[model samples]
Target: MSRNRTRFLKEFPKAISDENAAVFIGAGVSVGAGYPSWKELLREIGDELGVKSDDVYDLAALAQWSVSDTGGATRIRQVIRDQIAVDHDIPAPLNILARMPIRHLWTTNYDRLIERALLAIRRPCSVISAQGDLALKVTAGAARVYKMHGTVDQLDEIVISTDDYELFRSRRGAFLPLLQAHLSSFSMLFLGLSFTDPNLRHVLSLIRESFTDAPPAHFAIVRPPQKGDFRSAEEFEARLAQHNLWAKDLQRYGLFAIEIEDYDEVPGLLAEVERRVARNRVWISGSWPLDEATTPEVSFVHDVAERVGGVVGSSGLTLVSGSGLLVGSGSMSGFLSSLQKTGAWDLERRLIVRPFPQPIEGGEPDRAQWDLLRAELARLAGHVVFIGGLKAEAGALVDSSGVHAERAIAQAKGAYLLPIGATGGAAATIAAELIGSDLRFDGPDALRPSDEQLASLGDASVGAAELANRVLKILKSRML
Candidate 1:
């Protein structure tokens, strides 16, 4: 199980990096956001109808029974509305999921927590919550959310009754086929789902039935059956056996389960995956007014930036470019040249240029907003490179505050620091501070920067090509 978990943690992020990832969320994720689980929601309905929730094993049947007693779905809908109407906080795991590179989200939950999380990150989302929405087009690069079950807002159409389940494919139109298509193609992560939904099982069965031995690989995060969850040793053992078989059955359908000890470990697992995905993405920090300086040192700095960018591209890593005058162009050119050498000249593929919004409309430049922008971008990088970060102030050069801010942000986000100290200004100062305080070096030995190479980064005499090669070596040493 540990090996399977390791495999998922290692390779799933690559699916995201390759833009072939999708996520299927469930009621469990909404449970973390203060909403009731299926059992809890059933309990509420059970109490309403003088029925004990514990008497039923099939949750959908329990919901259908409530609908039957009401003579319509109205009372059941009211119960649902009253039970989960509170404003809920977006949980940590969901926030992390939103920040990931994944663009597709499929969920059976009725709540808007997923949308809210994406909205928090300002990710434009196209939500397909009902049959009619299937006709809509998902904008390029926009997040796509498929709410398979009807949302709580449309209470009359919500799928809680057996009749609704039976008629889902007919009533909901192509939802089942659409889900099946996605499941067949994308590398999906199943989060918080019980795998008990008849609709989901149908899709899984279709995928399995049409399989050619090697199906599209998928993953799920599940909690292993706990001994404390059952009454007797026999009961616990049976539950454990059942859990193991269920895990094995999922593998038959191509979903490898990664069992965690507890649900509380979810956020940490997600954070680690995010970190792993961010590695290999190099974000260079620092800016210089190349037009204002004619010194040979400045020329050396520009050369170093371009050389490093080329290595980053040739090594199959990404360059997250900054908009600093000369340095940005130099690095972009180098990155493009690397792409051209490989017969792939698409800059958009190898380079990321996320420009920041300048000064606020009414007042001075928004420092806080700029910091937020910088932090957001830094989170997407596994390493930060600093070089010639200086700005002209009162006819003299001073350290760029933005560069220093980026180092702090990158450090907090676990980004590797690769400062070219020979270029001087903010980068040199940062390198000096880092070396003197051993701040960035205070990590596991394997993950730490090489002491000899670290010193060369700050050496004024280090050549641009050597510095770039050193940077490549350091980057490779940390690849896990």
Candidate 2:
């Protein structure tokens, strides 16, 4: 990955965690979902006026001309509704954005793509198209979608013509104030935008003029101009220069541009952001001897759970665990109690349990059912940690859970896995397998394990704090 991408991956998570992240969607995003751009909509309007759309680059001006020629905005409204409005399935990028924990979304689009995408993901969103909608309180944790230009569903309120642009300051009422507040407060990520709309540019300029100090940093994902779209290499280079210049000028409004090689990269970048934002959720699976509480094996489980609890609780990460007696009951239960003592444990908010709806009733769930539940938990977690177990039923459960976690992590495409061999049981077996497969090893030592260390692991003599620290280290490394 490029340096800009790395920086974005690092900073975006922090922004989401702090509830200070917002998104700005542009016409290009809608276009990807088979909708027309402003120019395309204007082109159709130009055709009605006996003017070639390609000849008119100023879409707002073209819209004004159409409204004046027809003596009203009736034709303009019809054109937008006819050309831009649709009920197509939401695009992948929009779907990812909808599922993210972002609190606010600003869009200059007239279509309902953003709202549709959010609805598809079952994410509650309060749509703001007019000033009256601003007074309504949004549900807690629901995203607020600010349709700055107006939605196609309400043609009369849509901002398209140059006259609308000129009067936008006065007509928008509380919209501009709310937008300005978000700009000053949140870290905004602008997607699929060309930064060419005059009305939006003007509003941005006004915001910049009002700020004496540096404003909060914002970002835009821009594609470098393609050579295939130009007549010659020289023409392409000139276009690239102009694009670069426009991107640099946007810095005046505190919007830094992260240039991608092409539009195809956008979805991948957005998906990565979603993954990182979800990284706060972690899952743990393992088992130890439940019969003897004073045994080193059982003691290891309690000690490690306590230390891991502190890390998860303090870091504000959610913990997901199964309901198994030794693995889930011993580890997660202890962790929850520790967090409760610190006043950081909220069962509804900070914890998630798998196997709640028992796959089988009247008896112990079958092995396949347990595996399925563990897989589901692993799929939801950004990291999975395994601790201890022997060849008995408890150890068998631990081994199966570890295998399920590994498969789920693979299916997820990316997730951190920590198997502490020092804690013994299923964890030791998994660690040995990883070493043998050359998937992971202890530093530069390769598969060479000291006999004494291996013996200590089997004997469960490793300190719980040491095992917990190692797990935390692996989890942190994956985040970076």
Candidate 3:
């Protein structure tokens, strides 16, 4: 990763945890969801007026010309409703945005892509297009999206054409002040926006004038102009130079640029941000057969859990585990007791057990309930550590513990996995599988267990301290 990206990954988690984070979206994000870019929208309008689309640089002016030629905004409104009012499903990138914990979203787009995305994820969002909407009391657990340019739902209020841009201060009323407040109060991540939007430029200018000192630092994800897209190398270099200059100028408004190679990288970066923000939570999964427990295997599970609990207690990372009768409760109970002895047991922060729903009469949980619990654990944890369990019982295709570990690995997407094969059984099988396969773990290469290490994991002599040390090493390396 580049230095800027590293810095972002390291710092953004704290911002999210503090509830000081916000996102400012632009047309580029909506374009990916089937909407046209500002240039494209204006160029199409210009084409209708016998103007060469490529020759028109001032999109607002072009919009004004089209409205003037038609003698009303009816045709322009129709064009906007036809072009910007997309009813398609939200794209992956937008879905990531929808799932983010940030409660505030500011967009210059006129479409409902952002709102629709939030809806898709079942995240209730209060839309703010007019000043009156801001006066309405905010609902708890709902995100607030401030449409700075207006939305397609209200055509007359949309900020397009040179006239609207010129009259923005008077027409938008208190919207600018509310925007200024958010800019000062929150650490913002700017997405899918070019810094050149005249409306955005005006807002930044207002913010700059209001604050004597620098406001909270903000970030803008920018794509460097591609070399292959330009007609000539010289043209590409010139465009890059201009972009760099613009990036530098943005510092005056306390905005830093996170330059990326392409737009496709945006979703991945956002997903990583979400992952790192939840990094302090670790999940422990495994199930040993109580009737056939070996002394060494039992000793290994308790030792690993004890060491992990000590580390988690001291470092403030929460331990999220299942409530399985065998491995889950047996291991974690000892882990908690160890923490209590060290004055590190805090129920609110140190431990979280997502228990499987049980029958009222007291029997093994139904398959559906067990599966649901596994899914929840996978969703909650940033890292999962699998210990020892049976590989299979009788004619079963696979051990239930191994299946749960696999489900977690798949569902968590980028979660860190540490399978201690030394403990043997299902964990050893998982370790062997991972080491033998071609899949890459999502972290520094040094953090991943080597082939030689995997081969040694099945050894019965490896103690709990050593296994604990290995898991700690991976976690600490990632923090660095």
Candidate 4:
């Protein structure tokens, strides 16, 4: 079946519905955060031992043989820890996961990145390490970080080498139950892994054998236009069909592959993910903040929004000053002039005002008006606030806005309320509050407004003076 926006969004809700969702990550996730891939790490080890990258396979085999002759697994552990001191924290991906809402994490790699991330988030969690403690406890009801493979800190616990792998294979009874429970209930979002890893292949085989009747669905992200060893999109769909995995080509919706061209890009990508997770709770009302405006009143709304751009969130409650905010230009002009004269004068922190236009007797939102409004909203920056009442008839202006706003706030994302009461005045008030709180120009340590700033925003007409006053009020409030 073809996967589209509807299907993905629908599935996404299900995937994230559980606060204790299971997450199976692979080395690729770390690689995106700038850590070396398994192949790259192996090559690095080979190079350190005076061997070429292509000679990695043979050299690894030789190393394994040497270890076998000298107590095998124990000696190999010493080789990795002493001779190869892999920088465990040099490039950490835990920072990325720390921002996500996911609690449960399972990985085959022996790295401590996930544990580090969990600790950073300050969430109580249990780390299952083969070397340190196999004492699995479910009573805490807290998230668990199961390191199916051993970690670097313990030599005897390492899961490398053919013999060690075999031992784990035979000892599957220890961890299989937990894995099965997680797999059966949670929708898995696999990262930095593919169908190629032998360990993954074996895990999939075991899963297939365990749940022969009706296996849980699986999902994996693959870079588009499948390269080298990656299964083609069509082939992946067929492979997943065997284990009930329904593959979706993320590229169709602008996120097919990790798409990391350089190491520097990883940080930015991780930051974006952090921002999205944080923003996921915010919801906007009023003018959609992104919608276009039609009249000078609507234009005023857009102007306010543009100025208050810094504060508007994607999932926060955004009440647009709707029909209730629109009034005669004479009343608006007075409010604007009052604001301009009384508010602070900081040009650096812009204040946006969205105009709410009264429809011409029988008219709806005009095309030209919407186009102008959209352009204005697009120009918003710094902080955004809404006033007046626009959708009062639907009651959505109150209900939906509150739900979304609270959700955003719970996420530690910011949202402001202007109480859809005072036409453009509320917008000005909200802007003032944010400015007062802004550390940039507060206290004896505040930014002084320049003369040009006062002159440019002096007039009060067509929403210009009101916006200027809003800016001034923010600056003045913060100074106190």
Candidate 5:
């Protein structure tokens, strides 16, 4: 492999490995997608208002004029939306985006390039703009795009004016939470951003204020400081470091910062990233079986549900197996202890547990064992769950019962299948690949916890409550 390709591949795994990896896009990315540059956009706005581009460069100054003008940001947004909605060619940046295993994208640009890119790929994604009636929380679980700045169509929502910027600074409480949440948990990768944008700077500042306890983790692409025009890389890094934003040396990390002389190169770069992610199988996890691995393994349970939500007959299968038993408990405890829980526990219906280990050595497999095991699965209306991993050890039992255990519950007929592993995390991404859709959740709120612990499941990382929530979501999705 070439040096650039090799470096890209190395970083590729790191990006995929993160469950909360986010792509923070900026105006630069949109430029590749045929969107206007900030200067160009200002020029157009100036023409419409009988002013010069230089006059409108400052969003606050432009907004100040808006009080006297017919419209402010709204008109600008219309022009943007119209241009993007009609454009047919795939923008270069989006093409580059096609390859990466990015679950969420945070963009400050108002254009719909990200959405358009996703649409071109035929992936379903949510567009969150400040102007829209929709709130960010509703899109919590959605996996595709999160537009932090107001979209072009909703110019009123864009924070451009000095007053508007001040308002945003004061009301940072409203939107900063989502920003902090993403930064705290996910590894953020920024693209096409400039430090000069007030909104971006403000966000960086707000994150610093709220995250005083400890510096949060995030990554961004920046120009390597040259000696003459811009400040030294050291100075730039210092400024970012002060705010806890770690500036990456793109070249050092194997990321080539080339001037896009011909916007065409953008698509190829994006395509390469997409190709890498597609070739690599990304594992998603949250269910108990994933934890069963003594070492790390790529499992796809957390994001699968939304990925395959549209597929036929995927719904309503009460999947019983070691996974289900393990998931509902947040750990192996319930299934392990229940295996020897004695007399009769109410599994209700659609449950499965591990087989009892033989007490004596060299004991022959007998009928009493069959009857005892069959009775347990029968408690859940004869819907017995089995672990996909049991093939090597439980082959004889599976053969005797005549159950095709390897097949996914979705593939099984007429059964309400609830996959007990990975919480459909990586599976959802795979399902998207198979079904050719990108419908996935972006936030933890979409991860519905069961009634047993929903109240306590607030946002704690891992505990019995969190585990219970993960299990119930897997279970109820079966009913839906």
Candidate 6:
């Protein structure tokens, strides 16, 4: 990777983690999901007017011309409705983005694909499509999507004509100031977004005049002009030179432009960002059987889980786990205790505690549904820690299938494994694999568990707190 790309991969995730990052989307993003591009939307009007798309450089002017030619805005609006009504399956790039913990999403497109993608990932979003909607914030648990140009649901208020661009300030009035504030406050990632739009160009000028110093760093993912993009060789050469100049100009506003070969590579780049952001997120997967009396092994496992949870919470790592039988509460209590001792109040943001769905109708639980849930939760972590993996079945203790399934899912997703062998049950076999059979841990050499740490984990003499400290050392080494 280039230095710029590596730097962005490492730093952008941290920006998102610190709540200092935002995403600015464009029509190109939705185009991948079968939405009409500006050219495609205007092509219908162009056909009626006997004009060609190749000849037109400004699409907003084409829209205005169509409005003038028809002597009304009815046909234009209907065409827009028809163009936007076409929907397809969500693209991979959007899905990857939805999985991240982004707070602010800005878009110039009229489609609801952004919010729809977020909702599909189980994240509800408050959309600011108009100035009045800006005050309606979802304070409880939702991200905000700013549809600056307007949305398809409200056809009359959409911004598409040349007049709308020229008079955006007086009409919308509130968006520019808010946008300026956001640009000054957060690092914005421009995905499939360009600076050529009249509204954005106007805001850029406003921001330039508003700030005496350079604005905060921003970025754009752009497709550079290629040789075959145009039929004429001279045209391609000219546009390529223009793109080079455009890249340099972007630095004036502290916007770094990253060029890629194709749009398909976008999902991979986003997955890298997702991986970097989730390194500090730890997922606990285990259960304790409640059949008969709690054995000495069960007690040891429960103690270890609690101490592990306390280490996770106190050290600023986000905890994700399902409410397994007896072990889940121990971890939850330890995490809550740590938060209470530190006087931190952001429990909702710091933890994701999902209760496993109870079995219905059948005596046995649905393996498929549980599999789906475990996969979703494990995707949010860079490390998986297993302990006390036991369940009650036929009134007897047995190794937990959930723990083994979680281990498979986590391993496939390339997470670092930390299983306590001293707790025995399902975790013992897995830990034995680490000691002699296989090296399942996926992390840097500096963060790798030493033989001493692994042996101490399985040793009968090692106490609960000491084992938890060893695990914390590996997790915190990533930060170092």
Top-scoring candidate (TM-score): 1
- What are the TM-scores, per candidate, against the unseen true structure? 0.90, 0.83, 0.75, 0.49, 0.46, 0.89
Span of ten consecutive residues with least summed lDDT in model 1: 439-448
Error of 3 at 31 (Å): 2.2
**Residue-wise C-alpha lDDT for candidate 6, range 4-46, written one tens digit per residue:** 5766776788878777889988767887788876777778889
Candidates 1 and 6 compared: the better one by TM-score is: 1
Q: In order, what is each prediction's RMSD in angstroms?
A: 3.0, 4.4, 5.1, 17.8, 17.4, 3.1
Residue-level lDDT tens digits of model 4 in 1-480: 235323433343344432434567776666665555555555544554566645454333544554556654555565556532354553444566554556678887666677777776566677786633456464364557777776666556666555555566575447776676766666555556653343565466545544534444444444322234344867655554532331333222122233333445545544443433322221122332212235455566544443333222111212122222222222233334434554633222122245546578667756567445433332221122343223333433322242233223322322222222123333333334333343233233232223333232323352644553454354334211
What's the lDDT of the predicted structure labeled candidate 2?
0.70
Give the alpha carbon lDDT tens digit for every residue of 1-480 in model 1.
787789897788877776778998877788877898777777878888787876666777878887788787777788788876666999998899999878889988888888889999889888888898888877777888988887776777677778887888789856767777777778889888654443456456655755555556789898877889778999889878877888888888888899888889999999888888888688877788655668887888889889988988888887896666767777877888898899866565457787665565565776777887788778888888888898888888899887888888888877878788888889888777666555545343222365566688877675899888888888876654
- Say which prediction, candidate 1 or candidate 4, comes out ahead on TM-score: 1
Query: In lDDT terms, how accurate is model 3?
Result: 0.72
Worst 10 residues of 3 by lDDT: 439-448
C-alpha lDDT of candidate 1 relative to the true structure: 0.79
The global C-alpha lDDT for each of the candidates, from Candidate 1 onward, is 0.79, 0.70, 0.72, 0.44, 0.43, 0.77
Candidate 3 lDDT, 322-394, residue by residue in tens: 7666667755765676677778656654477987775775466587766666775676666676776664457
Candidate 2 lDDT over 1-480, as tens digits, reads: 255566777787668756789998887787778887666768878888889876776778899999899999998898888887778668888888877668799888888988988888678888999777888888886888999889988889988889998888788867876777888888888888875554557656656854548677787888878888778999889878888888888777777778898778888888777667657777666665445566765766666755675566655677777755666665576567667777864666567788444455457647676656666576566666666654346334345444445445533545555556666666677656654353433442122233433333434455776656555654554542
**Candidate 3 ranges beyond 4 A from true positions:** 44-56, 64-72, 166-173, 206-216, 227-240, 271-275, 288-310, 318-355, 359-380, 387-399, 402-414, 420-425, 428-473
Q: What TM-score does model 6 achieve against the real structure?
A: 0.89
For candidate 4, give the lDDT of residue 273: 39
Cα deviation of 39, candidate 2, in Å:
1.3
